[model samples]
Each structure stands twice: as C-alpha cells, then as structure tokens.
Target: MKQQTKTSKNPWVWIPTLYFAEGIPYVIVMTVSVIMYKRFGLSNTDIALYTSWLYLPWVIKPFWSPFVDILKTKRWWIVLMQLFIGAGLAGIALTLPTPFYFKASLAFFWLLAFSSATHDIAADGFYMLALDDSQQSFFVGIRSTFYRLAMITGQGLLIILAGALEIMTGSDPMYVNVTTSPTEQVDYNFENIPEDLSNIDELTFVVYPKNVTINTNKISTDSLSSLKEFAREHNTKNGFIALSETEKLKKNRLDGGETWWSHNISTPLANAIVKNFGVKKEVITKTTDDKVGNAKLVAVRLNKQPEEDKEIVLNTGFAKGDKSISIGSGERLVFNSMNWNVPAYILVQLDPKLEGVTSASFKGISGNIPLAWSITFFIMAGFFILIFVYHRFVLPRPASDHGSAANSPSDILHEFGITFVSFFKKRGIFIAILFMLLYRLGEALLVKLSSPFLLDIKEFGGLGLTTGEVGFVYGTVGVISLTVGGILGGIAVNKKGLKYWLWPMVLAITLPNLAYLYLSTYMPESMILINTAVALEQFGYGFGFTAYMMYMIYFSEGKHKTAHYAICTGFMALGMMLPGMVAGWIQELIGYQHFFILVILCAIPTFLVIPFLKVDPDFGKKDK
Candidate 1:
C-alpha cells in the first residue's frame, strides 16, 4: 500500500506517456485523417461522413471500462492498451497505401479508437484509484494540461513533418546542358551628308561608300523598297534625293532630279506626295552604331539647311541598293539616286566567347544535390533521436502502478473477457443510455446540417460564406464558445446542484441551436454578427455539455460503474452518429432553413429529459 502510495504520488510519471498514447491516435484519426483525405482529393462530404465515424470508439468506450476495473489492475490495462495503440499506428503507417486502404485504415483506426478509449478508461480509473479525493482534485489540472499537450504534439508536430517530407520528395522538372548564340551582324557607314539635316529631321545616317562590299544574301529588296517609298514622300526638293547613277556624274545638278552632292531639301518635290496627310515636319532619327543594338528615333519638322552642316554619311555591310530605312511621321532624307534610297543598316556582332549564355533553371529539392543530402541527414538524425527517446525512456515507464504491466501477457485477455460479459448486465444502464442518446440530439442534428445548409448561398437558403471564412468562424469562435460554455456550466452545476441546473443546461443547449435558424433564414451579410451568433451557440454547447458529463458521472455510481459509463457513452455516440450519417442527404432534400427548423424541433427531446436527472442536495457541500 505504501509502495502504491509512492508510485501514485508522482502521477506526472505516468501522464506524459499515457496522454501521448491517447493523443497520437486521436490526432491521426480526427485531424490527420481529414487532412490526408483532402490531400488525396476526397470531397468534403465524404471526408466528413467517413471521418465522423472515427468518433465511434470514443462513444462506446464506457462499455469496456469495467473489465479494467474488475479483472486486472488499471496499470496493466494502461501498458497493454498503449502497446495496442502503437501497433495500430504502425499498421496505419504501413497499410495506408493499399487499394482498399480506406477501409483498411478505418479498420485500424477503429482498433486504435478502441485502444485509445480503453487507455482513457484505465488512465482515468488509475488516476482516481491511485490518488485520494484530495489528490485527484489537485491533479485534475495536470492531467488535462498533459492531454492538451499530447494533442498539440500529435496534431501539430506530425502534420508539419508530413508536409515537409511531401515537399522534399515530390516530383519536379529538371533541366540539362544547353547553349545559345547571336545569329547575325550588319555594320553601316555615315559620310557626305548635310549638317542642316540634323535640325530638319535629326536624321543620323551611317552610310558606306557605294563601292563597299555587301552581303546580298543578308538584304531583302522587298524590305528596302518599302523604306524608299516612305523616304521619298517625306523628303522635300531642298532635302537630299536619291540620284540615278547617270545623274550622279552630272555634277552640280539638283533642282528636280537626283544629284551626287548632299543637299538640304525642305520644300515639296515633284515626285514626293503625302498620303495620310495630318502634320508635316522633319523628325530626329537617332541610329545605333550597330543595328542589332538598341536605337532611338524622334520626330521634328524639317525647315532648312544649316551653313556649318556636318557631312552626312552612311556605311553598312549590305549593298547600296540592298538596305531598309524607316522614316518618322514628319522626317526624311535624300541621297544620290545611284546610292539606293535605303538607309545604312547596323548590326551589333555577338562575341564568340559569350555565345554560350543560357537561362538560369530551377530544379527542385529532389534534383538539387546539396538539398538532397541535407534532407537525408536531417531525417536520419530525427529518426534515431525519436526512436532512442521513445524506447529508452518512454516505452519502459509503466502506465499504471504495476512495474510488470508490459510483461504480463495474460492480463489483457482476462480483462477483455470480463469487459465483454459485464457490458450486457449493467443496471440503470438503459436509462443512462436513453439520456445519452437524447441529451445532445439537437446539437448533433445542427452540426450535421449547418455547413451544408450554410454552403448553399443566400438564394438557396445558405449564408454563402467562403470556405476559409467559414472555417475561421466555426473553428476559432466556435472552439472558444465551447470552452466558455463548459466552464460556465461546470460552475453553475457546482453552485446549484444537478436538478436545479438541469433546466438551464437544457435551455443553454437548446436555445443556442436556434441561432442557426436565424443564420439560415435571414442569411445575415455581416460577418461579425454571424460569427458572434456562432460563438454564442458554441458557448451554450460548452456550458450544457458540462451538465451532461457530470450526469454520466452521477449515473455511473453503482457496482459496474465503468461498464455503465461505457454504455451511456455508446448511446451518446449513437445520438451523434444517426443524425450525422444522413445529414447531407437530408440537407439536399429540405434545404438550410427547413433543415435548421428540424434541428430546433429535435431539441424538444433534450428538454423532456430534464425531469429524470436527480440532483444530490449535498453535492456542492464540503467536509471540514
């Protein structure tokens, strides 16, 4: 007894392992299962329906609680159940990919649920048995805290790891050795032109002498003709004109015919004519030394020639007649007719050394040599550390007070046999079952129907909320309200006893459910109001659920208390399961507003159950 006292004194020793065992499977089934199904592209309704079934083991847990009580020490049940849970996790990790993996995974999860539920029973019973009432009171907070931590570890850490792994190993494209080069180059010359043309049109021509060698293959006559026509229309009689080869030799002749000498032609010429006449002016045309390099051209009116005019010239590798020059809206230039009306073409040559330039490519982590090694090393280290810690420290610690809990093999079989038989014989079990089934009928119905109804959009009776916003309202506000309601309900029950608090619990639970009716029918546009109402309903549920849990405890007071409690939980599970199973189909039939009305109507049964719950007059009274 003294040894038992010492072992129980350090309840912390058992909690981490026990809660860790409870938390991992719960997280896998409840949170990770949903996420995994989503990742695999399962629909919301399917995920909801399938995942909701995972809650079954928890609901039915109370039925098997007695075997742990009567046959073996709670400590034995704890270690064995932990082993079962670990195996179930291993099974899920391995079998999740099979063709029938969903069903198989469900099977494993059901096993895990049973293991987890049994663990909960043992852990809770052991907690009560190991400690005196005072110790139990003092350490309740510790147990709850550890359980929450376990939840965080299971839900948070494992998901992060899985996500990271998926990112690292996932498929991504790869690039190979490739190269690039500049294709061609053309140079031009500039000389023997009037400087006055600079102000007239700002035409910067780089011309080559007519005798310069050229690449006929590189020049297109069709392109050059288009430019010549444009230039002729813009050029005036005072501006330079393309002279015929015969006219080039006829020196000093530049009135209406082409001449070899550069001329500042600003007036209209006989052949030149404007087509789409709007504004007439010479424009500045800046040419790049290399045609391939970036160039600039600006438009300005041509007036007259300047005295100090610099000689205009053009040079290009293309033949005199095989070039293309573009004219601005109001600009033009002239040259000897022997010289083609085409301007010199410039091309910037690419260096041979720099020809191999290639684009930068990103090959994801898998193809990245450095990252692959890093990830491999990191995973290895993490794997070893986890294994060492789990086996060395966590696995050896007995869940119950008995040191031989893990080693004693037959203990589980015996406990299972007893739990199996007593489940059928418990007393007040029927009433407890009925109460559990009826208590939260309205809540289950509302939860099952609300999202589908709300998703329909206002025209169809839904609030038309976006997925993210809905998740936020339901997850954050709803969770907070649930906590608040539970706390308040616990406080109210402690103050007034079960009988007095029963009516309020019923009201709290039932009335908040009406908020859904308001939300569905009115289809409120204000997010704040909708969210507030959601929080309010959640608060009511939290408060009211406290009464429900307490009543279960009250009803489980006789010979097979654990077994009776399990039976009650099974009915509770049934209550939720029945409503949730067909909720989607029902929503399809009735729509949001009508479905919510059905939920409100279901509350009537919960309200009717209030009279049957007895309150202990001395419940809140204390002994000195």
Candidate 2:
C-alpha cells in the first residue's frame, strides 16, 4: 500500500522532468547562489570571485565527460548525480546556521556544481540513446523549453519565495519620511546641532527637522565648510563588513589552498586591470566655488539592548518620489548590544539640480538573513530528494545505457585525451578560443555585479530594490524579454545569415549596457523604470547573444563536432570567469555609475576582434 508497482516509461513522462531537473541544479549553482550569497551577508568582491570559480566545473566538464561513458550507464549516472545534488543541497542547508557558514556552504556548492556538470553530460547522452532520431529532433525543443522553465523556477519563483520568507521571519518593516526644500536650510551654527542620544535606551530613528532645506545654487564658504567637517568627523561605520570582520577575511583569504593563489596572484592582476582600465582617480584642484550637493544628518539608535547573539542589519533606501533627494552615506547599518544606545548618523544630500520642494520617504528593513536563506535551501533540498526518488522510478531504461566496452579506466582517459588534443589542434584554434573568451567581456563584468547593484542601498548607488522586486526584474521580465529577443534574432538570422547579422547582434548585446549606465547615473526610484531598463538590456543581450551561439555552432562544425562544441562552451565559461572575478573588486573601487561606464567601454574589444571572425553567408539561413 505504501508504494506503487510501476511508473510510466513514456518519453513524455521523463524527458521534460529529467531536463528540468538538470537545469535546476545548473541555475542554482550558476545564478541563484549569487543572489543567495548577497542575502547571506557576503561582500560582493567575495561573492563574485568565489562564485566565478564555480564555473570551473562547467569549464572543465568537457575534460571529464567521456569518463561518464566508462564509469556507469548514463541512466545510472543520472539517478546517482541527482542523489548527489540532493546531498549537496542538504549540506548547504545544514551548514548555513553554523559559524563558518560561508566556507562550508561554498564547499557544498562545489559538490552541487560538479554533480550538476556530470548530470548535464549524462542527461544529454541519455536523450540520444533513449529516443529515435526523429523523436530526438521532436523533443530537442521540448527539452530546451523545460530547461528554461527550470531556470525561471530556480531564479524567479524560488527567489520570490525566499524574499517572502525573509519578511515573514523578520520584524515589521520601518519607514522614515524626509523632505527637501530649497528655502528651508539654516546657516552653520552651534544652535542647530541636536542633543546626544547615546545615554538613552530605546530603539528608534532620530530624524531631526522633518523638513530639510538646502541651497542648491550656492552656499556661504563657512557654512559649507562646517557641514563638511561634521560629516567627515561623524561618518558611520560600514554596515556590511566591520573592521574586525574585514581583517578576518583578509587573514582567511590569504591563509592557504586556492585562496592563497587568489590573494597573491589573481587579486593583484585584477587590481591592475581595474587601475589601468577603470575610472580615473580624482584630481583635486583649488577652486573659489563649492560642491553643488549639500548634506544633512539623520540618526538611528537602539532604545534597549538587543540579544547578544542577534545582529540587527538594517538596509535603507529611497521608497519613492524625487530621485534628486537621496541618502549620500549610511545606507547600510548594523546595531547590537554593544552599540545599542549610540546614535549612527545617515548623511542626506540633495542633487545640485534638485529645484523647488519635494518629498521622499526612506525605508529600512531589518531581516533575519541566515534563517531566511537556511529555510530556502532546506526546502530546495527536500524538493531535490523527491526529484531523486521520482527519477529513480520514472526514467526509462534505454538499451544503449551502459558502461564503455573497454574495461580499463586508462582506456577512457586515453580517449578523453585524444578528444582534448583534437579540439586544441583544430585549424585557427587560437582565434576561435580568443573569440569565445572575448565575445562577452562586458556582460561578464556586468553579470557578477548586477545582483549586488540591485540589492544595495540607494546611498551606495544601487536601485534599492527588494529581493522579490529584483527577482521580478531579472528572473521574470528579463527572461521573458530575452526569449522574445532570441526568437526574433533567430528569425532574422534565418532570413539572412550569421555573417549578415554579426555586427547587429554584437551591437544589440553591447549597446544595452547603457541602460545600466543610465539607471546608475540617475538612480531612479520607480520600480517600473528599473524594470524597463533591465528588460531593455536583457533583450539586447538575448538578441546579440544569437551571434555568439551561432558562431559556436559554426566553429564546432568539423569532425568531433559534438565534443568540440562542448570544448567551445568551456572556453566561453572561461571568458566569463576571468572578467567576472574582477568585476566586483572594480565596482567597489568605482561606484556603479563609473563601473557601468567602463562596461560600455569594454565593447571596444568586441568590435576590434570582429573583422577576424569569418562565417559563411548562408550559415544560419533557412536556404542552407
């Protein structure tokens, strides 16, 4: 009564589900983990550098793929890898509450990444063996559709679910309303200063002068000088990384293993890249004029001591209204028993062009980050367990699903070595590798930093979007628009050819970088505006990306095409990884605005390499 006798062996019953399962772990390892790390309290630099390395599994998956043939039946590998994936998810969930959660969870993610990469190899192999040639063609699109659905589920629905849980598990959100008027500023004076609230025992925001006025045009030298001095003197400590935590990070990062190499070698190289190619350092000049933006102070303090074990992390940003009025600093804040009563100041500033009277509310939410993410991963783990069980029974037993005829592991390695050598020895292989690596340089730089940009507070130059809002922007709308763009791009390429569409596709991908540049420069408060910007950028990326994919298919057309294509993907991932590792480090040095500007500049390399690429006139054309 507890178990059913048999499950259906129909391709309908398994192809979609198997591919869906395959996509889930890939998306989780590649994209979802970046968002999870952000919500879990990792600095962007660490998140990008570490997660980009996760690509190592996929980058080298081609190297080990043939081994999947010798080790076990593709069916066996599929079921076993699903089980391993479930174990990885469970491991992450379990370690999330521990003191060294970051390191421990990353280890589990590696397990997930490796298992998923193997699963990709096995699942794709099984598809061919299980179905007839005609059936394979019929289900190819179906498998891709389900795979994409898996991406949306992992990125969109899963993220929204986590965000909701974060709210449900935390305290009621707090909102602080502030206003700026051109006529309401007071001159520099001791009388305007507020009382010290350090002795008071209470948890509340101490927003002084609900209506703040400043001179947008010009201000007296003495008054400007006084406010600047005060802001410098009372600067709030960073909310995300404390001095102690930062030192610990440096120590841990440099201690040993791969990190030792990263700290000494990769870190310096990345810094060098940033220094040479990133935004120029500021050069101060003597001037009779003053800074156009004016600043004011707002404070937050705890009324009572918090529980010793709990750390309250408060992230603040503009809720709505004029974008010109913004928090210049103190976007992220942390308070605990040790600093319960002392007031932390947030510096507010007005854009020099902000004219007339306008009002805006800055909202802050303090959530229990670890618990929220812990629950998310635990649920995923449980879901994977169910998937493992279902696949164990449901997947069809194909005739071709068997280990290699050769008995020796050495034989398998030898064949793999041949495939690798053949791939490397292809004509114009160097050019092909360079094209794969450089094609998406700008996107590589942008992808690793986008989540951090969306999630960071307004004071730090992010859009101040919530997790759900961000999920909606990228996971939902971005994906949908991307699909449409890809479909359109395919149609256009089919009508003409890859050679004809190459420049347009490249432009489509590279030009939309300006959307991000515009958003960061203006820092708009509207969610709709943010969504539109992201959609435009993603759509362009999807359209332009058609060329990159076509080029890969084109390049992989010779003997050992399938294996060569896999190697091409490895090179593609390497391209993304190298640029991504440095993205966050550079973004932190320069703000988002300049970071995006540099991203736009990266397109020059893409264009520079274009003349070297050769594609047949009829490559993607239907007539071919």
Candidate 3:
C-alpha cells in the first residue's frame, strides 16, 4: 500500500516518457534499420524481406501475452524489457564493425524486436491497469502523441544523425563534375588506368571526358533507349557485381520462407499481374525525326587511396543539376582497399534536343560506413539506457497493477485459457478480427519500402533524397502532420463516434497514396512538394489509425481487457508483417511505380472489411 501511494503520480508525469520508450525500439527495428542497411549497400530485396520478418515477434506477441500477465507485474516487465532493448541496441553497435556484421546485427535486431514486442504488451497493459476507464480515454491522445514523436525521432532525427556522423567520420565529399558541348570534339576518356593509388588524407574525384559532346541533331526518337543501352554495355564499374537475372529468381537459404514462397507462388502471380495491369514504359516519343539523348562514357577514379583499414563508401548522385544531363548508371558505387586504384566508369547521358554548351555536377560523399552505423547504434543504446533509468523511478505504480486473481502457475494457466476463450467469444469478434487484420494492410506494405524508394537513386526510379532529407521529410513535417491528424481524430471521435467518421478517415488514408504515384511518375526535385505529399499521407494514416486503435479498445472492453487488447494488437501486427515481408521482393520484381500502384490497389480490402465492422453508437464519446 505504501509502495503504491509513493508511486502514484499524475498521468501527464509518465505517459509521454512511457509511450516514448515504447515507440523507440519499434521504430528502430522496423523503420530505421531499413535505412541503415540501404546505406551499408544491402539490396532492396534483402532489406525488405529480412526486416519485414522482424514483425514476427509482434504477430505472435499475443501468444506470450498471457505469460507476461501470469509471470510478473507490469512494472517489472516494462523495466526488464527496456533493459533488454538497451542491451540489444548495444549488441548491434558492437557487431557492426565485425566481418559478419549483417548476420550479427540481425541477431541483435531480433533481440530488439522481441523485447520491443514484449514491451508493448507490458506498457499497454500497464496503461489500462494504472488508469481508470475515463482516465484511459482522456490520456489516449497523449500516449499516441508521444509514440508518433518517437517516430519522428527515430525516422527523422536518428537518420539525420547517422548521415551527419557519416560525413564526420569519413573523408570530405568528392565532386564529379561534367560540362557538355555539342559543337566541341573533346574527349577525355582515360588512356591508361592507374595500378596503385598513394594514400592521402583527402579524397578528390576525377571524371574523364571532362568535356562531353552530344550531337543530338535529327536522330530517331528510338535512339534514346539505344543510347542508354550503350552506356550500360560500356560500364565496367568494378568492385561490386550485381546478381544476374536468373540469380535474382533463384531461392537462397538465407531468405527462408519468404524466398521460397516468392519464387514458387508470388513471382508467377506478380508476372501475370504485371503483364495485364502494369503500365508500359515508353522507349521513344511519337516524333519520328526528333533529336534523341546521347550517352557518354565518363571514367572515374580517386586522386588518392582511402584511409587504411577503413572501407570508405562513395555515394554519388544528382545534387542539383540540369535534369537532362543525368547519370544513366553508376550513381552509387563503393571504393575500398582492393579497388581504390581501379577506375569505375559512370554513364553520363544527355537529354534529347541538346545542341549547345551546358554543364551539370554530381556529388559523392564518402564515409566509413561501418564505423558510422556503429556509432549511431551506440548512441541509440545509450538513449534507451537513460530512459530505462528515468522510467524506473517516474512510472506510476497503481494499486491494481497485479496479475489476475490466480496466484499459482496452475491458476494462471486456467486464467489464460479463460481469457483467450472470452476474447474469441466476444460479439462480432470475427468481424473485429478481420477489421483489425485488413485495416492497415496497405500501410504495412507502403511503410516498408518508403525509405528504400527515398534513398534509391533517381536513375533507378527513386527520389534519391539524402538520408538527412528523408529524415526531415518524414520525421519532422510528416510526423507533425500525422500528430495533428491523430489529435483531431481523437477529438472528432469523442464528439461524433467512429461510425460517423469511418468513411472519411478511410479516404484520408488511401487517397494520399496517389502522392507516391505522382512522385514516381514525375520524380520531382522540390522538397516542398515531397514534404507536402508525405505530410498529407502521414496525416491520413495517423488519423485513420486512431479509428483502428479506438475500435480495438472498444472491442477489448471486458473482464480480460488487457489480454484481449494484446490479441487485437497481435492481429494488427500480423496485418503489417505478412505484407511488409514481400514489399521489397515485389518492388524489385516490378519497380517503385507499379509497386505503389499495387499498394493503392490493396486498399480495396480495407474498404471491403470496414463496411462489415460493427461499432457502438456511443463507444468513443466523451461523457459530460
């Protein structure tokens, strides 16, 4: 009784920190890790498939939710889970410098995923136990606010931090500039390649064919494809070789279930879908005798070797330049101990209708990637440790924060059986479960690949935004929009109820996906446009997501509300996990444009399931 009194504090005192801690690990596992792997040169296929599997712990968290209840107090679970999450983060930092960093870091991420899943169970359960029904309803918006803030921190601030750290720990950025003149007969291709490079403190870029000439006078419109193909054939970019077409189709042991399923089932199905509904890309304009783009070979090499024992990665792409004269290939390439001296050829292609002198530039930023990522994770680990310490003291301990009346192991199991049965036995539970499962299916798919699409070079049908830029777009502006939508959603639902706002929120979430379609088709460089799109989309998602959560809480209102809500979340995670696991594979098979189209098409299921959902007229209404 004394302990409970001492621990009791205002809900405002702890909800922010509690939910903030709850959100950090989930975002780190699900979102930030995708960007980290992309920076480290992991393929989209691997990043999506592997990271999507991290959702498994949450999918099956309900299986262990009862165990969480039967074993210890919610406070004990929350504190312990935080410590485990911190340990997992530290483990990732430790493993990043190792040779098997990929596998080792994945192991640690698994630890984070599981610990975070368990933490969600505890923290969410504790929220209900510590507050009365009215208090729970009132502070719901506050908790969600903090969680989204965590998303901003992880998705935006954390990524910006890593990107900044990348520059600090690595050499100064190297620029590969080009000037094109159609009238000039200048060619600066390397006559002889250097066999060895001397070590230097600074790295500078040298692009041969310093003056490019593209005579685009009266060529066939079809020449552009041929021009691009010529660049591809001439590119002998050394250091890394991509998988052959057949190799990408074949299954590997590392991929496990996702690979097998993708190969035998999803591939054929996807091919069929693409052949039918897929948008056909045009190789040439209708004009028969229009001037066509021409491709030029630009051999690139560093002025000096990178620092010894550190593998410096040079990520180069359009950093504000003439849109016509763009990199046809080799936007991002790595340089290391073995290949520092060997020159890699980049295909610089000119846009059709070029007849005069014009110049453009691409910038490459080099960084000690392993070290940068390690330091980033190290900082995250330290943050969790600090939060763990803070919550250990500040979290309120209510008198009702114990397990069910069952005091022994046998009694706990009996209670678990009863709780599980009651949850499934709830009125219209099948519809509730379906609503939970299908509500966020589209988001599950989109969320997984959004980062990859942002980081991928423009040449490969992506936005090619810098890591820091992606962070700000999604984290700051997007999160702010989402938070506003969510807050408004809670208040609106309080006034009008879920039934009144369901269809509007549905449109809110699904309609903004068109922003990606527009982005992929146009590939705009304006940050304002990009942020606006993201903000609208995130706002809709955050708003729509409030309805989903309220429905879960509404459905789980019962004798076993805590355990029942866990089951609902389990389904919620399942909705995200299954689709996210295959998002990358699909994107690779098709491209970002079609992949997004498919994501939009997926919204049909959400709409279909929603009409069938049963809701109370006064479920979320605030009492006077």
Candidate 4:
C-alpha cells in the first residue's frame, strides 16, 4: 500500500520533456554546431579544432559532478541550469552578427556546453530521486524515445529549415553587359576564316563576361571572399563557361557577319551575349536593350603588344579613319572605357601574327549564406525560450537534503584528487583505460569528416549532397538505424552476456567503415546509394557501441561505483575529442578517398586492444 501510494503520480509529465531538454543542448553544441560552422565558411581545420574544444566541459565533467551532488538539491540544479542554457543560447544568437562573431559565439557555446554537462549530472541524479525502481524501469524506453525525437528535431528539422531559409535569402544572379568600342574596321586583316577555332592562325581580341558578384551584405563579404580563395586553392572553382563547341559554331553560322568571328570567342561570353543581348545578326547594331543593362568596356586587345608599342590614343573616336584604333599586323589594337552605349558590337580584329587568343569565364553570383545562418541562431533562441517557460511552470520540484560535503576550497581540491587517485588504483586499470581510449578511435575521425565530405562539390572528390539531402540521409535515416541497432544490441548482450558478444561487437563497429571508403572512391551521385551507405555505417556504430557501454559498467564495480562510471565516461569523451581535433587537418591534407582508407587502418588499434581487456561471462545477463 505504501509503495503504491508513493508512485501515484503520472511519470509522463516530466520524463519526456526532461530527456528532450537534455538532448537539445547536446545536439546543438556537438552536431548542429559542426554543420553550422561548415556553412559559415570556416576551414575544416578550424571547425574541428574549436568545436572539439567544446567537448572539454564534458571530458572534465566528472570533476564537477561531486559539486552538483553536494551543493544543492538535484531539482534546483536542473531548473537553474535550464535557465542558464537558455540564456547562453540567446547570447549565441545575439553574437552571431557581430564583427567578432567567431570568437564571441564560441564563448557562448562554451557556456552552453558547461551548463549542459552540469545539467546532465543533475538530470540523471534527479531521475533516481524522483521515481521508485519500478517507475524508473517502465519510463526508460519512453525517455529514450523522446531523446531520439529531440535528435531528429535538432539534426533534421532544424537543418532542413535552415537550408530552405538559405534559398529564401539567396541573391539573384547579377547581369553585367560587356561591350567593345571600336565597331568600325581596324588595321589588322585575316582572309582565312577557319571553320574550326582550333585552326585559327592567331586567336586575338577576346571579349568575355565575368560575373563580378559584390556581396552588399556587410557581415558575410569577408568570409565569402576567404571561402572563394580556399575554393580556388582546392581547384573546385565551378567549371568554366556553360556552352558547347557545337552550340558556339551553330550560333556563329546563323549570325553571319563581322560578329560571326565572335563564335570563336569563349563560350561563356558568347552565350551571355546571345541569351542576354539577343543579337539576331552577327553585327549588334542599334538593337533594343532588351535584357542588356549598363555596359562597361573594361578592355579590348587586337593581340599581345610589346610594352613600347602598346598605345592608348583615346583622344579620337572610331570615326572613319581614327589613329586611336590602331590594328596593325604586328601592332595590337587596345581600348579601355567605363561607359555604356546603345546597340553594342563586340568587334574582334584578329591578326594572323597573334595566336588568336580569346577567352572569358563566368561564375554564378555567390549568395549571403550567413543571413540564413543568423536567422537559424535566432530560431534556436526562440526554441530555448519555449523550453524555459514550460520547465519553469510544469516541472515538479522534488524536495531533498542540500549540504556541502567540502566546507573549504582546499577540501574541494582534496576530494577531486582523491577521486582521481582511486580510479587509477583499481586492478587492470591501465589496460581498461587503454581499451576505452582505443575502442572508438576510427569512429571519432570518421564522424568529424562525414558532413564535410557530403557537402563538398563533386569535382573536389566529395558526394556534393545538398544540406537538406544530408540532413535527411544522415539525420533521419542514419539516426533511425542507429537507434534500432542499439535496441537490438542491448537484447543480444542481455541474452548471452558481454564476454560472448565482445568480439562480434568489435567487428560490427569497425568493418562497416568500408562503406565510407567505397562511397569516397566511387563518388556516387544517386541519393539512394548514398543513403544506403550512410545507414549501414550508422547502424554498425549503434550496435557496436553497446559493448563499449557494457564494458564501462563491468569495470565500474566497487565502493565508489557512481564516481568510477563518471570517470570512465570522461575517458570516452577524451577518445572522441583528441582524434576529432586532427581529423580535419588530415582530411584536408590527403583528401577524402585516402583519408577514409586511413580510417579503416585505424581499426587495428581497436581490435588489438580488445583481446587484452577482461569481461565477465555473466556481466550483462539477468539471473533467472
């Protein structure tokens, strides 16, 4: 009767929201932040480096768990930390648009990371305090389900929304008209107009349109420029013009005149004139502006002229026989102007002496992606706001004893030292620590680079998946498989015990990495193929991770069982952080294909350490 009375209240009210809150900040700080930084134009090295530092709060959290236990009631810590996390999120949104946004926002993320880690300690402790053993067991799956839902919201819906918003904020393509001033006949002569441009004696006098995208947004211009430079360095500058040789030749034949030679010009510039200016005849004389706006005659050249021979007699116009337009056999005609004129003609005076040099390139206008990113921050801030309000009113505040275990600063330091020393003193402690560190070495490197490889352009040896596609494939499909695998792993370990399943779990975790290697090698464009591959890798990770958790539980047996488990988790976090910090730099150096091959090689350490580690035959089994 007494036990039934104690558990009379419904468990549904708080468990779902409690676990959901716990998951949001973690996903935000860890996974969402990685994607956000990539879209913000940070180098992979910087993204991996700084974001890895955010894990410090979790790595050293064991040192602070004792403080949460002794200093206040668990309910107090949970509520207070939620509010703190909420404020930190708002701060991130506020700092995103500032000049020092990277440094400023990282500082706020640090605050959120620390608060979230402390909240984990409080939330777990409170779970034990608030419910009886039966109630706790019944609600475990419910809490897990809600937690995964939060992961979907953070990783899937949020990312998809941001991607959609990016399209909304995208700048329209800017059009600039390019024209040549010297429309009249020049001094140079070429009687043999070769059908094939490759046969041209001296390909001279080229006029092509280059898209000069000037980002009017003050906040993102610098980052975009840096990204452009990085892209150029990596050789992913979006491939040259969008015209085929046949199209150019067909247009030249249809036009038929002085401007017919324009077909031999670069594809991008010629295509733009045809599409934008709508020049029906080869000569563009007195045609309506149509889509053509103000023109800039930036430069014109008959051919490469010697420094001494190069002349700019701009005082005279192209009226009949002007000395300003000098098109000699050896002398290259040159002109420069920043003015617009009606019915602009792109006249090319080809000299047989020159090698027929004509080329121009066009690039799409780069958009302000940060505008969308900044809006994402604000949206997250609002999400935290709703969480704060709900938790403030609805969450039950359980009563408990609040006492300070350490009265002074020295006492606190001494407690921390003792806690560290006790873990190190356990039997087989060194080997156990090595097993924990090496178990997921390959996974740590692979997770950090996964998003980057997906987002990179196909030309750069990446999958070139869009943000929404990546969100769906990895966040929706991959996470679903991971959860299913974890559930099955638990059932398998419970039936046969950890010792029997240890080696199989290790293989499950390490072998699926080959999927990533294959994807990078083939560079598959089909979404179905990419999603299938990602799902395989994630399912393996989820299933294999169960053994790692079971080992920690097995090793944490003793007088200070809870404290030992916390210490074990710290080592797990360290394993992820250390390798992740350098993963990006390595990927950047060797590229994705070789980098994944290297990831497969890292599996050796994982397998090598497993044989030496001890596990109890009946560790995870229930006594019937």
Considering every candidate listed, which one attains the maximal TM-score?
A: 3
Off by over 4 Å in 1: 5-10, 13-17, 20-24, 27-49, 59-63, 66-101, 129-133, 148-432, 448-476, 522-527, 617-624
**Candidates sorted on TM-score, descending:** 3, 2, 4, 1
Please, what is the whole-model Cα lDDT of each candidate in the order they appear? 0.51, 0.78, 0.79, 0.66
Candidate 2 Cα errors over 4 Å, as ranges: 1-8, 179-295, 307-309, 320-325, 350-360
* Comparing 1 and 4 on lDDT, the stronger one: 4
TM-score of 4: 0.70
Against the true structure, what is every candidate's RMSD?
28.2, 5.4, 3.7, 18.2
Record all residue pairs in model 3 with backbone atoms less than 3 Å apart, i.e. clashing. Answer: 188-209
lDDT of 3 by residue, 1-624 (tens): 123434558888888999999999998998899999988878787888899899899888878877777777899899999999999999999998877889999999999999998898899878878887788889987897789889989988998988888888776676666666655555453775554445544576555654555554444555556655554544323553344222344444345535667767866776675567554664554344455566666666777766554455667777665767777777766676666666776677676656677777877787777888899889989988998898899888777777654577787778779988998888998888888888887888899888889888775678888888998987799889988888888898999988888888888788888888888988888888988888888888888888888989989998888778878888998888888887777777677898899989988988888888888888888762
The residue-by-residue lDDT of candidate 2 on 374-471, one tens digit each, is 88888988988998899898887776678876677687667678877988887777777878988899999999988789987764567777888877
User: Compared with the true structure, what per-residue lDDT tens digits does model 4 show for residues 330-390?
Assistant: 1111221211111111221211122222222221222235556678777777777787777
Worst 10 residues of 4 by lDDT: 324-333
Which 10 successive residues of model 2 have the least lDDT summed?
A: 238-247
The TM-score values for the models, in the order shown, are 0.53, 0.85, 0.89, 0.70
Worst 10 residues of 3 by lDDT: 240-249
Local distance difference test, candidate 3: 0.79
**Between the candidate structures 1 and 4, which one is better when assessed by TM-score?**
4
Better of 2 and 3 by lDDT: 3
**TM match of model 2 to true structure:** 0.85
